[model samples]
Target: MRIVFILVLAVGVGLAGFAVSIAKDRFDQYQTALAEQRNAILPTTQVVVVNRQVRYGETLTEDDVSLIRWPAEHVPFGAFTSIEELFPENDELRTVVRIMEQDEPVLLAKVTAPGEDAGVASRLEEGMRALALRVDVSSGVSGFLRPGDRVDIYWTGTGRSGEGVTRLIRANVQLIAVDQIADEQRNNPTIARTITVTARPEDVAALTQAQSTGSLTLALVGVGDITESETVEVSTSELLGDVEIIAEGPEVCTVRNRRGADVIITQVPCVN
Candidate 1:
C-alpha cells in the first residue's frame, strides 16, 4: 500500500511539469509574434482631417477639423499636416471646394485660398458667367430657391406676334447665390431679393435682353432631377384652356360700290 501511494504521487508531479513546459512554449511564441508585428508596421504622421461632415463652400474653422495619426506610407498627397498649413494667420478664405465626409483627409486641392471668400468665382465653371437678376417673392420660387439649385427661367411679355406670351428663355440654370450670399451651406429657408446664376456666355445675352424687355421668373427643378430640355410655353389659350388669344395687326378696310342694283363690298388694306 505504501509503494502504490508513492507511485501515484510521482505520476502527478510528472504531469504538472509537462503542463508547465507546454504553457511556457506557447507564451514565448506569443511574445515573438507580437514583436514581429510591431517591427512590420510603418511609421505614422499627423494629418488634418474633417472630423465632421462638411458641405461645399462652407468656411473652415478649427472646430470643423481634427488631426489624426495617418500611416506615413499611405498619407495622401497634398494633405495638410497642421492647422497652420490650412488657415495661416486666421484666414477665412480656406473654404471647402467639394463635399467632405467625416474622417476624410483634407487635401490642399479640396480647399480654396486661406483668405478668399466663397465668392462667385468659386461657384462658376470655366467659360461661365455669373448673372444677377432682380427677384420678387413670386419670381424667386416663393423664396424656396437656394444656392446650388437648378431652375428654368421664363420670360413673360409681348411676343413677336404682337401678343402676350410666356416662354422658357433658359433651361437648367444653376443658382449660385441667393441675395448677396454665395454658395450658402445651410438648408434653411430664406427670402432673397436678388439671385445670381451661372450661365454659359451665350445664354447671358438672351437672359439680359429678356429681363429688360419683360419679367423673368424661376421654376425650381426637383432635386436630383435629370431630364432633357423640352419646349415649354404658355399662351392665353394654354393657361385658360379652350381660350384663344387674338393678335390685332394691320386693319383691313371695306369699300362698298353700287353697280346697277347690287352693292359690292371689297376688302382692301387700310392706309395710314
Candidate 2:
C-alpha cells in the first residue's frame, strides 16, 4: 500500500509540472510574436492623404496618406486608410482631406452638392442675413420668388366679433423689408408676389401682431416718403374730446295727439 501511494503521488507532481511548463512556453511564444508584429508595423510609412477633400464614391487607399498623423491623436490612422471613412455612407458632405508629400501637408476640398446651384449660394456674401417670405401673384399662390423683388405684406380680417364690434383692432401690416426701393417702371405696380421688408425694432412687433390678429395685407410703398412714429397712449376722453358727438338725452314721455302716438317728445310744464 505504501509503494502504490508513493507512485501515485509522483505521477501527480510530474503532471502538474508538465502543465506549468507548457503554459509558460505558450505565453513566451505569444509575447515574442506580438513584439515582432508591432515592430514591423512601426517601421513602415503608410501612404495617406494629408489634407484633401473627401467626396462621395472616393475609395480609401494606402497611397492617399503618407505619414499617419497619430493613431490616437489628430486622426485614427490605423482604422481609416483614406478620407472616405470620416463621413457617413449616405451623408452629403464636403470634407477637407490632407496628405503628407515629402513630409509636408497638402490640403484638398471635396464637393458633395447634388444638382444645387453653386453660383447663387456663393454670391451671397458674408454679414448679409437671408430671410424667406411667402409671395403670391394673380396667377395663384407662388413661392418661386427670386433673390430680388419688391413686395408688400398685408393681413386680412375674418370679422368674427359681431358686425357692430370691430373684428380687428388693427389691420394691414405694410412691407417687411427696410432697405426696399421700387422701380415701378421696371416691375408691376398693382400686384406683388411676396413682400420682403426690412423693418426696425418697433415695426417688428406690429408685423408680428398682424400675423396673429388678421391676415397680412401687402400694400406697395413707392418712392414716396415713408414715415413711422412711436405710438403714444391716450384715453378715450383725451382722443375724442374735440370730436363732435350727437347723443340723445334721457327719455321723457309725454302725451302727444289723441290718436295715441308713441313719440319721444320733450316739453316743459307751463307756469300760470
Candidate 3:
C-alpha cells in the first residue's frame, strides 16, 4: 500500500510540473510577441481626435476630444497636433462647422474661431452684409433654396409708363440662410418665409428700394456658376414679339335720353 501511494504521488507531482512549464512557455511567448509589435510600429504624431460624436454647430470642449497617435506621414492638413493647438491657451470655446465622428482628426476648417459662436455673420466673408429678405414659395424657389446657393434677384412691378416690367436687380447674390437657420445639415425642403443673403454694402440700398417698390423674386443659379455678362432689362414688349397693338381708346359720344323725359327722345348712334 505504501509503494502504490508513493507512485501515485509521483505521477501527480509530475503532471503539475508539466502544466506549470506549459503555462510559463505561453507567458514568455506572449511577452515576446508584445515586444515585437511595439518595435514594428512607426513613429506617430499626437493628434487631437474627437473622443465622441459631435454634431454641427455644437461647441467643442477638451473632454469632447482626446489625443491619438496618428502616423506622422499620413497626418492631414490643418490637423491639430496637440490639445493646446486645438484649444489655444486651453480655451475650449469653439463651434463646430461640420459634423465630427469619434477618432476623427480635428481640423481648423471644421471649427469656428476661439470664443466665436456659429452665427450668420460668422459665415459671411469680409465686407459682406447679411440681408434678410422676405420670401414665399414662389419667390423662395419653392423651398429648394439653401445656404451657399447663389441666386439672381428679380424685381417685377409696374413701371412709370404703367407697363409691367421685370428687371434683374442683382446677379449671383449668395444665399446664406433660409428663414433663421444657417445650418448646412438642414437640407430638407421647406417653404421658408424669409431668406438671408450676403451682399455688398453698396447694393443694400438698391435691394431695399426694389423690395419696397416692386415684388422681389429669386431665381436660383447653378452651383459654382457665375455669369459676368450684364443682364438686360425686360418689359412687355421685349418678352412678346411685335406686341405693338394699341388698346382701344375712349370715344366722345353725345348723351341719349329715354322716351319718358318730355315724350320725345334723341338717339346719338346708340352712344357709340
Q: State which candidate has the highest TM-score.
A: 3
The residue-by-residue lDDT of candidate 1 on 1-272, one tens digit each, is 99999999999999999999999999999999999999998899999999899877788898999999999989899899898888787555488866789999998767777776566786677789999999988998888888889999999998887778899888888888898765456577787899999988889899999999999988999888899679888876567778657999877799999999999999988888
Better of 2 and 3 by TM-score: 3
Candidate 1 vs candidate 2: which has greater lDDT? 1
- lDDT score, candidate 3: 0.86
What TM-score should be assigned to candidate 1? Answer: 0.59
Q: State in Å the error of residue 133, model 1.
A: 0.7
Deviation of model 1 at 104, angstroms: 3.1
TM-score of 2: 0.25
- Alpha carbon deviation, residue 114, candidate 3 (Å): 2.0
For candidate 2, the lDDT comes to: 0.42
- Candidate 3 lDDT, 101-130, residue by residue in tens: 899999987888899988886787788898
Give all candidates' CA lDDT scores: 0.85, 0.42, 0.86
2 versus 3: better lDDT goes to = 3
Backbone clash numbers for all candidates listed:
1, 38, 0
Task: Compute each candidate's TM-score over C-alphas.
Answer: 0.59, 0.25, 0.64
Question: Candidate 2, residues 132-232: lDDT per residue as tens digits?
Answer: 23445632123322223333454454444422111222222333232232211223343344444444455566656756764543333343535442333
- Ordering by TM-score: 3, 1, 2
